[model samples]
Target: MTATHRTYPLDESVDAVIIGTGAGGSPLLWRLAQAGLHVVALEAGRAWSDPSADFATDEVAQSKLYWLDERLSGGDQPTAFGANNSGIGVGGSTLHYGAYVPRADPRDLRLHSLQGVAVDWPLDYADLTRYYQEVETFLGVSGPSPYPWDPARSYPLPPIALNTAAHIMRRGCDTLGIKTSPAPIAALSQPYLATGSEHRHPCVHRGYCHQGCRNGAKASMDVTYLPAAVAAGAEIRPQSFVTGIERDPQGRITAVLYDRNGITERQRCNAVFLCAGAIETPRQLLLWQAADSTLPLNDAVGRNFMAHVSTQVWATFPQPTYLYRGFPSTLITEDLMRPDDADFAGGYLIQSYGILPIMWAEQVARSRPLLGQSLVDYLMQYPHVSGLGINGETLPNADNRVTLSSEKDARGLPKPHITLTLGENEERIHLHADPTLRAILTAAGGADLWISRRTAHTIGTCRMGTHAKNSVVGPYGRSWDIPNLYIADNSVFPTSLAANPALTIMALALRTADHFLQQR
Candidate 1:
């Protein structure tokens, strides 16, 4: 399937224009095109024309898949941008994700009402149940059935086979009396025949999920939703960098202005969907602010930024584990994921993980200046190393935000400045979880433990809420000031769930697409 590409006459119009082709925009595009709406999706990076040729297992070459825009990390707990969190190209971050797709715990939606801390989502888990089921089935998600948190349905496919890393983690979890389950991932365990003649092959278990999947096994947008969208007649324009949104006197979005190569073009549309993720979505909003300072868009457009606080706990086993043989993550323990009686406001999930040698070396280097033989000594024990990572929920703080910087990019737009700091609550979760994770590893005959702090899955930049002044978009992802404008990305997440966010992001996209169709 192919999409019609519009070149520089600068005057093509569509019923709707989507700003990104990741998990968010791809599903929305497919749904809208299926509903007979003319949709154009703008992707900032080049398409993965030949995955086998373009993608490699090497770390240095694979770094090209990330979003390398010049972003300044501010405040105390500055995040490692590009390689760690964001992605580039046609599939967006899904191109390099581990494909972990756990659904958000029901408590994640009622954080305000349950714990009396952050703002609650305008909608709850009950509201998103059907959409979640739809996305899970569409992606052929594989996991243990009747998950303890949400026991409504079984997975579309059986779980991925557990690797040695998973076995090791399970042993430790059993000793600690923690309940463990197969990691729910979007990667198919068996061949899946999707809607409209699209078939996805099962995962080969190459353990390079972060790199582009060469076999079309992982459910990245490039292999899944984007192709379906193109087959349904949605125009996908690659290398099309959206600069700003054009609004009329009444502040209704009318057209999207973007630059392809060196040529500027305008695509007129009745409605616009901002699916540019948390970072670029807010950056685009700030760019629109520069265009019309008097417009009464929501003041919280770029506030309340939340990225899950992640920390890696590494240990050395007595023998070689060959941790990088299968999927990078396989076993997960969510025992600590709910704030039942915890001192922290939110909780976290512990999952088995395997890192490439280059990533491990870089992480070790960042923690302490390990040069000379010391670095070689650390690298020598690679075969005996295994690790577990914590995906802890982070509270949204207005100070931790995405703001426009004075520094400009090649497009002559101000670079997005990201200021993120760990609050007391998040720090408490880390302090508590780290020791628990270490004890588990120790019980599994592990030694030489090390913990490194990191951040994963950025969310909540363009928060959704019930009120107009407090949020950028409403419950349905429709803008309060501009009725036709909508957001279909992680940017609209109200709270960062302890679970990996890829599944929830796609679910929200599906819900927003349905709402747009209903309105039409």
Candidate 2:
């Protein structure tokens, strides 16, 4: 179904107001609307109504889809290319994500109990098993059946076809005695017949998944949940920038203020959900606190910012691998994700990945002093390049955080200052994983290899926990101070799991929506 782009009056009231129609808000919006609640979803960016026409396979042109807002970066390992990792449109970052949908290991939930490092999640994997299955089914995820990790259920569709790059990685893994499996992804391997009016075709293997799927095969929120929400009578307002939230004397959130085009508007709502992502959610909360001094600000609101510690190893093979033909990631190994006697508290996931020429050039520029002919020479042999990377679990450090910067954006709100430093544990994990990746590429008959350290996924800004002092939200995503306010995003994660965060974020959103429905 085509989403209804409706404009409501400034003073209009609804049962729920959701900020940012991304992976987090979109699912909750659909659930609430299906539960008979009037919901309004506010998006900060423009909606891509016609992705086939609007999106381009050209890497330089596709860079416009990223979130390029001013965000200052600091620390020993600052995220120099922050915008490249996130998106700015209606579907949020999911618009540009590779659609990897690996589930977090059950051990990930009990970090504090088992490893004695970070705080444990209020609920375990058992609490989200049903919701994970529900979200996977709704998104039509494709994966190998009888997963070795013991997932609660099987995937709805068959696994995506592995490319030559994945085949090379699998051979290397076999030689090294490492366990390998087909990577689970949200992109459809077959045509998905929607329950509503929306329909999604099979992936064309265009190798442009990160530029927003032009064929509607990717399960981005715009094509899936957002449209379904609108079909269920939910209103989605694009380019609506939420500034601050208001609460009554009883400490119940009553309204949300936002900027639409050039006008400031206020919308009254019975409940408010903040899903503006890790950086923006805390920034908005800080703005709210600045406006209302009486509101209690959680000290941990933006304290523990965590992004995955990623290091890529690009290898050039003798033959043309055509690595960019299919999905970017097709094979994965979690053998090193958790070792019984590892020095590090957490682990990492190594997977086969393919990069476009422009993206490869940009990554090279960011990491080293290569430029001009040096980079051009590397790009000259694009067809022979095959890549793999380790998405290592990062521990939440109190010092690595997002704070309100003195500089402001066009909307007169303070820009978010992000500081990310690789902890000792992460460094150790990377040191081990980097060599392992190098060895795999070597075994795959790779001649030249390039390694670069980078940041991948973001999490743990508004962490949820059992206590009020250490966490921003409770187990159900309810704010500790404001009863009617909820946070449904990766920001509420207490621990950074060694997996892509999209699936977990969706499951958590569905669980939070169910909790809200029960309360109502």
Model 2 lDDT per residue over 113-228, tens place: 99899888999688888888888888888898877666445888999988887898998888888889888889899998766537789999899998889998999998999888
TM-score of 1: 0.97
Q: Which ten residues in a row have the lowest lDDT in candidate 1?
A: 1-10
Residue 470 alpha-carbon offset, candidate 1, angstroms: 0.9
Residue-wise C-alpha lDDT for candidate 1, range 1-520, written one tens digit per residue: 3545433223656789999998899899989988988889999999988787889887788988899988988888888878787898999999998888888878878889988999898886877888888888888888989875656668989999887778778889899888889989888899999766378789898878887888888889988888888877788889999977777877787888899998888899889999999999988888887877865667788888888889888899988988777888888888997646679877999999877777777888887567999888988888889988889999999888999999999888899999998899999998888888898888888899998888888898999999887889989899887778999999999899898888888989989999989988
Give Cα-based local distance difference scores for all models: 0.86, 0.86
lDDT of model 1 at position 402: 93
Model 1 pairs in collision: none
- State the local distance difference test value for candidate 2: 0.86
